[model samples]
Target: MAVQPSRPLRLFADYLRLERVNLTERWMKAVFNDADLSESDRLTHEQLSDHVPEILGEIFSALEDQDLDEVEPSIERNARQHGRLRWKQGYRIDELVRELDLLRQVLMGAIDSFAQGHPTFTRRHEERARHFVDEAISFVTLTSIREVVTERDRKIDEYTGQLERANHELLLKQKLVGELYESRMQITRSVVHDLRNFLNVFAMALQMIARAPARTNAALALANRQAADMKTLVDELVEYSIVLGDNNPLATEAFDLRVLFDELVASCGPAIEAKGLRLVHRFDPQLRTITTNRLKLKQVALNLLTNAAKYTKVGEVELDMRAHGDAHWRLRVSDTGVGICAEDQQRVFREFERANQDDVPGAGLGLAIVSELCRKLHGELRFASHEGEGTTFEITFPLRLDPGG
Candidate 1:
C-alpha cells in the first residue's frame, strides 16, 4: 500500500554513504581552499572539515528512509554548530551562506558524475536524485539561517552588556569629580572668611601703632607679627588654589632642604612658644640639594609643623629627615600632642573632617590639602599614634619625578 523510492534514489543514497569521505575532501578542496573566499584560507583542514561528512550521511539516510524528518534533526544540529564556529572565527554571514551553497553544489556534482558513469541510470532515478538534493539544500539553508540569527542576537546581547558596564563606570567618575569640586569651593569660602578677620585685626593693629607713641615699640612689634600671620594665611590659600588649577603646582629645582627646614621652624616659633612646647629638628647631611617642588614640599612641612604646634601641650615636637637611598628621602614630624584616636584617624585626611577635635581652630582642610599635595608629588603619607601619648607622621618622597606631569 506504500510507494517505494525509485531504483536510482536507492543507488544514489548508497553511493553517498560510501563516498562521504571523498565528497568531503572534494568540498574542502573546491570551497575552503578557494582564494576568492575571504578569511576561509585562515582556517585549518580540521575546522573546515568538521560536520560535512556527517551532514552528507544524514541526507543519504533521509533518502534511504524516503522521509525528510529522519534528517531534519541532524541538519539543525550541524547548522547550529557550523554557525557558531564561523561566528567565532570572524566569518561574515554572506561568506558562510556562500560556503553552504558551494557545499550543495559539490555534493550534487559528485552524485551526477556517478550517475553518468553507471549503465542502469534512468530518467526516474535522475529525478529522484534531483528531488533528494533539492530537499536537502532547502532544509540545510533554512537551519543555517536560523542558527546565524541566533548567534547574531547573542553577540548583540554581549556587546550591550559591555556598554552598560562602561557607562556605569563613567557615571561614578563624574560623581567623584563633582564631589571634589564642591569640597574645593567649601575650602575657599572658609579661607576667605579667615582672611577677612585677619585683615581687620591687621588694620586695627596698624591704627593703634600709629596713635600710641608711648608704647610705639610694642605696638609696632604686634603689628609686624599680625602682618606676618596674614601673609602666611594668604600664602596657604594661594598654594591650595594653585594645586586645584590646570598646571602642576610643583616647581622642581635644586634647593637646600635645611634652609627650608629652618624657615619652617622659625615660622612656627610663635605657635610653639605660645603652646609652651619645645621644637627640635635633625636633618640628614645628604638631604641638601635635590630636584622637587620646593614650595609644595615647604607647604607640606609647614602643615605638619603647625599641626604639631597646635596639638602638643607640654612635651617636645620633633622634625627629622634622612636619605632613604639615592632615589628617595624620608621625613618625620612627631609630637607629644593629644594623639588622634583610632576611630578618628581614618576620618582625619578627608575634607572638613577634624578627627573629633572641634576645639582646634581649623576648617579641617589642613591635612586634607597636605594629603592631596602628597599624591600630586608621587609621595607616601603614613602615621603612628597612641591617644594622649603622641603621634608621628612620616612622608617619603621620590627624587626624580614624573616629567610628563
Candidate 2:
C-alpha cells in the first residue's frame, strides 16, 4: 500500500507561517527515515495530507458541487498542519478527533489538579507538569515515527541476522503458525465483508419501508422491526469484531443494570416462549446501577438463552443477576440442558469450536463472542456444566467502566 501525500497548509494571512509547516515536515521526514516502520506509515500519506493544492482541489470541488460560503474552512485551510494523524491505519478519523479532544482534556486536567492541590500535583506541581508534557511529546513522536517509515528491507535483514539464527536451532511448526494467523485474518475479512453487506440490506429495507404507502401500516411495521433487528445484528457483529477481530472494546455507559437485564429478557421472551421454554429472571435486591456495553451484554445473554432453548426439550432457563459491591456485578445464565463436557470446556470459548459433532447449524461463535466481551471489559466469562444435567455461564464485570470499556 502506498502512502498518500497530505494536503498542504493554507496560511490565513497574506504571509504564511512557514515555521510550523517546516517543523512538521522535518518531523515527518525523520519518521519516514526511521528503520522500524509499520503499515500505518503507508496510510498517513493519504489521510491528513500536507499538499496544499490537493486539499484545495477537493475543497474547490466541493464548492463547485454546491455549497460555497458554508464550506468548511478546516478542510480548505491549514488543518493538516496540526499534527495531521496520530496513527493513520490502526485508527479512524473520528477516533483521532476524539483522542485529540481527550489529549486536550488531560492537559486541562493537569492544570485543574495543580489548582486544586491534588496530592501528587500539589507536592510537585512544576515537576509533574514538566514530566507530563515531556512524556506526551515523546509518546507522540514515537508513535509518529512508527507510522511514517516502512524499511521492509532493513527489517528483514535485522530479523534474519539476529533472530533467525537463534530460532533456527529450535524445532517449531513454522508453517502451522504462519497459516494459523493467516486463517484468523481471513476470518476477520470475511466477517467484515458480510457485515457490510448486511448493513446495506438493512439500510435498503429502511428505505423501502419509508417509501411504502402509509396504508400498508402492518407490513411497514414488520419491515421496520426486521430492519432494526438486522441493524442490531450488524452492530453485534461489529462489536464482536472490535472485541475479537481488532482487540478493541465497545464504548460503555453507566446504565441501569436492572433495566438492561429486563430489556434483554424481554427481547428474548418471545423466542423462549415460542420454543415452549420457561424463562426466569432472578435479580439481587441490593443490586445497583452498573456501567457496561448493554448490547454485548445482551448478546451474551441471548446466546446463552438460545443455547438453553435449543438443547433442553423440557426445563427452565434461568437468568440470574446479582451485584457484589459498587464495583462488581454477576450474571449467571443457567439452563437445564445438554451440558458441556469437562474435556470440552477448555475449547468452548474458541471461535468455531463445538462440544460435539452433532448436526448443529451454529458457527460456534457465541461463546467466543462472550469470552471476548468479558476480556474487553476486563472481567471473567466462564462456563460450568454437568453433561445431560445443565450448563451455567458466569460473567463477572466491574461495575465501574473498565480500562477498555
lDDT of each: 0.78, 0.57
Worst 10 residues of 2 by lDDT: 6-15
**lDDT score, candidate 2, position 248:** 51
Global lDDT of model 2: 0.57
lDDT of 2 by residue, 1-405 (tens): 112211211111111122334333444454455444333366464353344333333333332232332334443233333333343244444444443334334334434544454333343434433343344333443333443333334556898887877676443667667756875875677567545655675666667667775635665565566556456555655655666665454677877788877887888778877868788889897787677777767777777777677676667888899986667888888888878888887777765565564434344566777776667667777678999898988888788866643
In model 1, which runs have C-alpha deviations exceeding 4 angstroms? 1-99, 117-161, 181-235, 249-251, 254-275, 286-289, 355-362
* TM-score between candidate 1 and the true structure: 0.58
State which candidate has the highest TM-score. 1
Q: Score residue 290 of candidate 2 by CA lDDT.
A: 74
